[model samples]
Target: MMTAVAQDRLGGPDVLYLTRRERPAPGFGEVLVRVRAASVNPIDAKTRESGAFLGDPPFVLGWDVSGVVEATGPGVRLFRPGDEVYGMPLFPDEAGAYAEYVVAPARHLAPKPAGLTHVEAAALPLAALTARQALVDAARVRPGDRVLVHGAAGGVGHLAVQLAKALGAHVIGTARSAQHPALRDLGADELLDFTEVDVHGAVRDADVVLDTLGGPDAFRALDTLKDGGTLVSLPSPEDDGVIPTAAARGIRAGFMLVQPDPVGLHHLTELVDAGEVRPVVAAGFRLEEVALAHRFAEAGGVLGKTVLTVD
Candidate 1:
């Protein structure tokens, strides 16, 4: 049996409890992983507490996974037993990577970058995919572009800033003044202290704006965008909203939600392998401490990704 955290009812972290479950076996074209680590994200917090996406309790709460493949199902050709791999498993669904073993699509899994350890690799999947999708697939951030990233020191923001730079864009980031140095270290050309300065004034001439805020007021921030620039929102935006104004200004906007994509994970592997990107782990909790991890994550803000170490 594998140990995992599950909820009998949706509420708070207290509803989560450790329990034993039968070890999972890989399905066709999948790999059964012996999990080493998993990372916590706001999605898990929202889903677990509200049961919004989960639909019910007694469901697992994890997506990011880093582990060694212990077995493979028929038709799986990408990995063999004992191969170390990492991936963001099926999202808004059963990933169950919080347990000792998880079954993931073979194509979704990638070789953990040689430079990253299991714990570090565990922190990258969901956050990196979010940033990568926003910048590359949605905004199409390109060379010589001036990009602005809101909440830039948080889990996904930190990586987004670096990714913008790696894509040859000049990146500006917004965070508390205390986090400016950290953002700068991640290659942010400028930092906006959201507490003191107007976020719009801090960033002008933005060729691309990666907005992580899903709050109702975030649409107002778009007024600062230049004509023909792009805005990539990480949240589900309202219909007939940001788009009309963008079209009027000859600007483009993308309401992008991240998904598990094998191609993207493979791309991330290259960036990590070359030291062009890095995963910052803020804190790690053990499997039994999953509740504490959830509590810490919901406390408002964290400098980097909060992770749950399984083994």
Candidate 2:
């Protein structure tokens, strides 16, 4: 048996409780991971509230994991029993990473970056993959392009800033004044104080706009883009008019969902090893304190990711 954090019903963080369950064994092409750490994300809280992705109770919630492989199932040739690995497995599905053990497909994970500890590596998968996919794959951000990232100090935004910089794009970030110094150090060329400035007016003619804020901000971001620029919305736009609005402006706009990709994870690993990127772990809680971790993440203003360290 292993300790797992699960919710009996969909509601507030209080619904989360620890329970003992039979250890899950890896299936074909999968490996059993002894989780060392996992990160909490807004999706975990949202799903806990509405059961959006999960249909019923007694389901584990978490996608980010960094750990060592304990065992492997048939046809799993990528990793051995002691390999240190990390990934966001079965995302938008039940990954059950917030537990002492999880079964993941071998290809969905990559080697843990040598520069990062388990806690720090736990912070990378979902957020880093989201940022990398949005900027590199979807938007095709290129060198010398003027790229603007909304909500720049938050989870995905901070990584986007560094990635845009690493890809040679000129990156601008929008965040509260309090987060300016960190964003600057992350290589954001300009920092816009969204709380104090007219964000749309402060910037214009960006080659690409990465909208992590969503809703009205996603629509307004179109004004900051050039005629042929692209706007990638990481969050689902609250309004349905985003597409039509972008079409009218001769700009391309779309939403993105991060997926598990070995290629992308390998790229991130390379960047981490090269010192161009790093994970930011703002806080960590024990496996039993998952409810507190969710509540803390929901309270907002956390500079990086909140993680649950499994003992």
Candidate 3:
């Protein structure tokens, strides 16, 4: 039997409980991984609240995984037993990463970088992929372009700031004044204290804006961009009325849900190896304390990711 944190109902962190089940086996082109670390994301808490993404209870609530390949199933060629790998697999669906073991498709995972530990690697997949896909694919950021990142101190935001910088854009970030030094350390060219200033007014004519905070906040980001600039909202791109707003303003805007991208993971590995990007693990808990981890993540304003470790 293997240990996992699961919930039977949807509500708050209190809904979570630890249970044991038979270890899962890999199918064709899949591998069974002994999970070492898993990172909690905002989506996990939101889904736990609404049960929107995961339909019912008795489901696991994690996507980011870093572990060792314990066994490979039939026809698996990408990896073998004893390999160290990391990925955000089966996103928007349960890969059951909050467990002691998980089964993932071989193609969704990439080798763990030598420089990063399991906890750090686990933190990178979801947030980093979100940042990469949003900034590179959705916004198409380019050199010398002015890029503004909303909520630039949290997991996705901090990485977005750095990724924008890595892409050669002049990066501007909106964060609390206390987080300014950390964002600056991540290569943010300008910092806006949203708590004290009108962020839209302070940051005008940005070539691209990465909105990690959605709803009215996303709509507010439109004014910070140039007429033809792009706004990439990480949360609820369609429901926020961003499409029509962008059309009315002659700008481009869309929501980006991160996917499992091995290529992007490899690119991130390169960046990490080159010392250009790193993940900040703000807090950690044991596998049994997943409910506590979720509570901490839901409380908001955390500097980076909260992770769970399994023995």
Candidate 4:
């Protein structure tokens, strides 16, 4: 048996509770991970409340995991039984990472950076991969390009700032004045206080804009980009009315859903090892305190990621 946080029905954070379940085993090309830590993302909260992408309850809510490989199934070669690894496995599908053990496709994970602890490693996968995919793969950000990140002090936003900088772009970020120094330290070249100033007017001619905050905020970001620039909206869907407006304005706009990418995870590992990128964990709760953790994550105003210690 393995310990896990599960919900029998869809509702608030109160719906979450601890339970015991059969320990999962790896399948073909898969690995069984002894989860040491897992990070809570906004998707987890949304799924918990409304079944977002999950569709129902009686489900485990976590993707980000940092752990030791316990066993390998057929055709696995990337890791051994004792290797330490971290990843956001199965993503929109459930990998059941909020447990003592999880079975994941071997290709969905990468070696945990040696410089980081399990908690820090757990914090990186989903949020960091979102930033990397948006900036590098989707936006195609280039050296000296102007890259603007909305919600720059939040989970995905903070990592986006550092990644844009690492890609050699001049990174601008939107956050409260209180977070300016921290964003600057993370390599953001310009910091805009969204509460104090209008972001559309404050930043202009950005080569790429990562819209971490969806809705009207994504629409507002259109004016901040130069013609032919790319605007990648992370939280919003494609049909949110931003795409047509972007086309009319000679800009490219679309939404991106993060997926499990071992290659991207390796690149992130390189960045972390080289000191170019680091995940900021706002808080951590034990496996039993998942409900409290969910409440904290849903309450917003978090500096970075929230995590759960499975041990």
RMSD of each: 1.3, 1.1, 1.2, 1.0
Q: List, residue by residue over 201-304, the lDDT tens digit for candidate 4.
A: 88889999998888888888888999999999888685558898899878989999999998999999999999999999999999999989988888877578
TM-score to native of every candidate shown: 0.96, 0.98, 0.97, 0.98
Ranking by lDDT: 4, 2, 3, 1
Which segments of model 1 are wrong by more than 4 Å?
Answer: none
lDDT of 3: 0.90
Task: Report the lDDT tens digits of candidate 2 across residue range 1-311.
Answer: 99999788899989988889999999999999999999998888888998867878779999999999999999999999999999999988999998999999999999999889999999999999999999999999989999999888888888899999999999999888888998889899999988899999889999999988788888888889998899999777446898888888788898898999999999999999999998778899999988889878888775788999999
lDDT of each: 0.86, 0.91, 0.90, 0.92
- Angstrom error of the Cα, residue 172, model 3: value is 0.6
Worst 10 residues of 2 by lDDT: 234-243
Model 4, residue 96: distance off in Å is 1.1
Highest-scoring model, lDDT:
4
Candidate 4: C-alpha lDDT? 0.92
Candidate 1 clash pair list: none
For candidate 1, the lDDT comes to 0.86
Cα lDDT for residue 82, model 1? 92
Global fold similarity of model 2 (TM-score): 0.98
